[model samples]
Target: MRKQRDIIKQLTDRELNVQLIISQFSLVFLSIILSYILFDSFVDWLNYFKLSYYDIVYYGAASGLLIVIIDLVFMYIFPKKYYDDGGINQRIFRDRSVGGIFLLALLVAIAEELLFRGVIQTTFGYLVASIVFALIHFRYLKKPVLFVSILFVSFYIGYIFVLTENLLVTIMAHFIIDFTLGLVIRFQKRGANNE
Candidate 1:
């Protein structure tokens, strides 16, 4: 564990960003491959992209906002240490411009939802998919609070996907949550600097 933390501590922001990009795109590729193998046709995976504006607003965007609110409440209530994951998340967003952050968030949301919800959940059902989703967030494993938080969030997002049956809704929700939190990390740094 000590050696692992040491390795993580040595990673530069650029390296971390590159890793994030690679991981997300890899997931996207894996999703495509799995979908093709598991389903009848290559285009079948695209069915998950079906969009209903009403569901997007109600289930995706609204739930995203609610999760953000809940996160904020927890941030206020808990010690910052409980949320810490060796500062990897803050490093990923802190130095990025708003546009960069938005792009990163969008990429992550689409790629992850493509795999976790659109493919995995659709294949194996919600429980297995949600567990896999939460487990994939390996950085949070060392922090009990953050791990539990992610578990609950994964289940919540999976539930919404089940309800809407649209990947766009989950993608929107994921995008909003990640984008908002990225902004918070970025601005929080700026605010501290201005102090």
Candidate 2:
């Protein structure tokens, strides 16, 4: 954990953003490749993106807002140290504009949902997808609370996917959580700076 902290502290903001871009795009590419290998046809893969369930969008958005509220409550209740992730997340969003934050969050939500929920869960099962999702967030592994939180979040998103059977729903849910938190991080740092 100390090593991770030291390494992250050494990275420039550009380096972090570059790495995030590469990794997220890699996930998107992997989703495409995996879908190609797994599905019977392109059409079958396309079918996975069903957006006809308009009413479920509310459920997904509400789920996301609910999670964000719960997380904010947790942050208030817990020591700041418990929520720290080597300052990586702070570095990622603190300097970004609102538009930048929204774009980054959307990209992440889509890329992750495309691979984790759209491809992996659809192919294997919810449990497998959820486990894999948690594992990929390796930085959080050393932090017990963050690790457990990711597990809970992953499973919750997986449940949303299961209930809605729509990739867009999970993507929207993921985006809302990330975008809202990114804004919080952005303004929180600004407020700290002012203080």
Worst 10 residues of 1 by lDDT: 1-10
Q: For residues 85-129, could you state the per-residue lDDT of candidate 1 as single tens digits?
A: 887777778889999999999999999999999889998999999
lDDT of 2 at 7: 78
Please state every model's RMSD to the true fold in angstroms.
Answer: 1.5, 1.7
Listed in order, each prediction's TM-score against the native is 0.94, 0.94
The parts of candidate 2 lying over 4 Å away from their true place are none
Tens-digit lDDT track for model 2 on 29-137? 9999999999888678777676655634686788899999999998999899999998878988999999999999999999999999989999999999999999988
Candidate 1 residues lying further than 4 Å off, grouped into runs, are 1-5
RMSD of 2: 1.7
The per-model lDDT (C-alpha) reads 0.90, 0.89
